[model samples]
Target: MRHPLAHALRWSAVGVLTAGLMCTGLTASAVAAPGSPPDPALSTPGLPPPAPASPPAPASTTADGLALTPPMGFNNWNSTHCRAEFNETMVEGIADLLVAKGLKDAGYRYVNLDDCWALPERDADGRLVPDPVRFPHGIKAVADYVHGKGLKLGIYTSAGTKTCDTAGFPGALGHESSDARQFADWGVDYLKYDNCNNQGQDARQRYTAMRDALRATGRPIVYSICEWGQNRPWEWAPALGQLWRTTGDIGDSWGSMLSILKKNLPLAAYAGPGHWNDPDMLEVGNGGMTDTEYRTHFSMWSMMAAPLLVGSDLRKGSQATFDILGNREVIAVDQDPLGRQGTVVSSSGGRWVVVKPMKDGSRVVALFNETGGAQRIATDASALGLPGTAGYTLRDLWQHRGYNTAGTVAATVPAHGTVLLRVTADRRWAAHPPAVEPGLDGDPLAVAGRTVPLTSTAADLGRTTARQVSVSLSGPEGWTVRAASPRTARALRTGRTLRTSWELSAPPGTPTGSYGLTLRVDYRAPSGVRADSTLPVTATVVVPPPPGESFLSDLPWVSAANGFGPAERDRSNGESAAGDGHPLTVGGTVYAKGLGVHAESELAYYTGGACDRVTADVGVDDEKGGHGTVAFEILADGRRAAGTGVLTNTMPAAPLSADVSGAHVVRLVVTDGGDGIDSDHADWADARLRCRSAS
Candidate 1:
């Protein structure tokens, strides 16, 4: 979890800024750098360095001949942990789907069970027992069923006295030999050993004990160390396990995914064949992000050569989920025989160029956009370490299209999306059409009955010039689009772009949501080869809050992402469902109007520069019985305006107010307080924004 300090506070004291008023000056303490030292209370003792600036000596492989590439499998923890739906039938159904849905053919091979698979206590023989209700057929029977489909079975256990689930099933601490033998007897093929209730034991020694025990059983069970990167497993786990988790549990949101990726990016040198870095699991079908964001997640994971464990429920997966998880081209990058992980070529302003060398001398280039809006990301072949060539073959892996490039690889990527391409040197590339990528400029937000100007750019990035280039923009039905400039050109020279401006008008009754606008480009090559490309643009229609003071909950949000479940209105975040929470309560006080959300949550509203200030009573919700910690922040147009120091349930609700003058977008963010997000139910009580009528 990210626990950066808040931005400069304009008001000297809380509650000083009244409704419809603005504060002008900043407090010295509040204006300090946001990168203060980590809170002592939240620091883990005896932990290794989080991320080393320079790479260490190359790690020796385990030589176990397992996980030669990153493991591709399904884990049941993310979608249904310890729930009734995670029963024997569900496991069998997943195995059946792995074969039926073509996932097995795509290289997914393991069927793993997470925590809560065992009974709370060991039997009279001092051996762990399977939960009768969850796995009625027993462990061996389930293993046999999975093996019948040519898949492997993986089981979970903690290195401490109890597993991570609330039920605290028996762990394999002092029973390593007995437990390893038991797992081998049951035909287990993988072990996910976690770190919890560790009894202050040394991480390396404990994990090594399990390693030797598993090897003694003469079974090739792939070892996965799940220590959450507290002890820098990448420095030592390569010779002990096939993979080691480099971060805490992954949440199904763009922020969570991006945070973990940033953590894993620096440790690329520690990854190779038979041992790899695990950035937790895939959240493709978990429904916390859009399809475009999911594609980014998959593309980055594949680029980094991380494990491809399916974390969504297979029995209820959508076609989009299958499409992302079963992308064979991306999967090939992950399972490439070269066993090399991608390294960052350049990163700036949330635009990243990551290149991974393939076994065949080809390079997998990913143009990733992490900003909140569309932007052009580009890189040349020389930057990718490829030798000079007259022409290069550029394959858009996601679009499955090929083009002849003079060396430039670029795309106009959407917010939180990626454009994956494979580049290889080819001299006979003139036979294909030039790569003309489409992009949009200017703001994407439009008000009902208002005209918003937008520019569409078509860039020719290939060996041959694009001839007779034509560009057009189209929106939803009943919406109007009129070009303000010429929409066609005689030719688009290589490395050049043609721009066209348009006036877009939405109907007066247009709904306040995201609408798809298409940018289509058509061109021809000198060889008479014609090509056309269509890019999807998202335009958000927003209705700003009305004048005067209004409860924040009463206004429609432009976007909302929660760490756990959905953000509730006038209630406390209870679990993973809407309308499942109780009345909003913080420090024993109940509020009728507020937002209840878990830490690592974000809610954005289009203020349209109409708001002057926002005030709220913020604190951790008392529903968790004084057990959670969180921090609150207010950002006006991506610049922090106010923040609350770490707040816990034990404290009373803190008053907060922030200046929002001339801000187009106001965001309310809640983050876990240094520690992981466990029971971090946060609330913005009596939240109100004072705004003027939109011009």
Candidate 2:
């Protein structure tokens, strides 16, 4: 994983702190307001250009036959990085749980150790030494313990003079051969070689040195290049390592995951057997996001054929965590023998359809929803490169169900969720019941005590007709749901639809959060065979903006990210600790209410389409004493509504205003002013939003 010092040094050298921040965590994909217009670059026709006929097999440069499929394993960095708990006991416990919890059986094998496993300095013999307190029995004993459990062991080191952590542990920069021999002697099976304090060495030469050294050991250690995509490792690293990181470290948030997905999705051509495009490790079970988001994270990783490195503390994992991790069906996609990475079939309006051609001639279709609300994402078998067969069999990998589609494949995917389906041509598909895909149409954002009208539709995509079709929508406890129209139909012919309307009302005192709603569909065939399906729906309760002007700091933000520390309210960006900032000040003036943030920061608030205008005075905080430069921009639903040219700490505050009428979410963004992020403390003084009364 990347460290702050590495990021600061890398960006300061390039004088593009903003770009570095974008890769680290504050990516454009993460800050783009939800429900925004689709990126024009990703907008394609319903049927995208077909994938190459007979895609070439990945050329293996190492010739070791290692990592034939993306490595499935556990990495300790994300869960307990450099913590006292990340010791021999924890590593052994993870190995035990991997087997006891069925993860090893489900395809996870490696139990890896990240940084901090070693002492800060090497021994008198110039060999790296394991921390005595951390691994009292030594690395070999832990490696043996892991191997005894039928799993592999991975260790981390940097290609620089020191590892990424502040501990400055000795790295393998000039010691590649010695370290490689040492690791091989210990029975280490995998090596994560990172980029940090490299002294500006050539990435290729440095990595190749290790690759040659590892090969010299006559060991089959899987090499993972963690250069953070600084040198486009995908273009050359395949010949040197089994996998290369394609992005910066991944945070446990929807924005971070989505941003990395956008970065990695374009490099599908460079990934295959024995070599992979690593998009960092998995953040599942980390708890920064909901279970739905985690499912999407896992589903996308599997779809992309990316390395599946579990980055959670499995000892404290819950049932939901195990359920997501132990999904053998999803893991199969990642381990698909074909070794083809999934590519986008079509994308528009925050909905994406990605298809991966399997060796069995089937296609894995992932209908992904990146919007702020549930959406009906769809694609047809033809679009997925399937022949014009009479029928197609669809297996919902997540739901573990079988379905038959005449041609169209679709599902109502929740916000930040994915519906993974494996579709294959099946001539006997007609023998199965009709594949009725269910969808919900309505605003997912609801006001407390308001009756929101919603419609659910079931479309038959199977070859045969369905009889006695019925649909029901149920809300969470304390909420009322009533059918507004007929919920049953006598028949639903192929390609026809049955629609049911319902009025949903949440109690006045309902809290603000996502609530679950279930849409169940029951249908029978002409021969009296019956089938039922239940689809989950999500409704978010939001508080409308107050009438009249109100300071932005008073409202709870939907999400926030900062370059150096957490965004502060009505204060100056001091240090990393919360509430440690001074009063908001810029150009020697103090403000009573404002936001203090570092460069490359973003704060979003749910406007609920009620706010019409936002006004603020933006500047680099005077606390830096003319040391920082930055720019500010405001976005309404991902569209830039207002912005300020570069501003330095020496300049007075600049008034900024934006027309945010009809915007559901308004975002405030700050970026480094070209030079770097040194002392880049920014402020939004007296920021206020004006809204109409909630009707």
lDDT digits (tens) for residues 1-695 of candidate 1: 22212111211121111000000111222112211222233221112123345556445554668999999999987777666788889999999999999999999999999887888999999999998998988999999999999999999998878776556678788999999999999999999998765676788888999988999999999999987776777878887889998766786767567656766776787888898999888989977789998999999999999999999998999999999999999999999978888888877756889999999988999999866667788999999999898989888898888888998898888877899999998676777789998988744788999998898999888889999999999999999999999999899988898999999989998989989899999999888778987788888999978999999999998878776667888888754557768898888899999999986677988899899999999999876775667889898887889998889989999999999999988889887676556467899999999999888
* Pairs in clash, predicted candidate 1: none
lDDT of 2 by residue, 312-346 (tens): 89998989999999999999999998888899887
TM-score of 2: 0.84
Q: Extract clashing residue pairs from model 2.
A: none
The lDDT per prediction is 0.81, 0.80
Every candidate's CA RMSD: 9.0, 6.8
In model 2, which regions exceed 4 Å deviation? Answer: 1-59, 556-611, 614-687
Kindly give the number of clashing pairs for every candidate. Answer: 0, 0
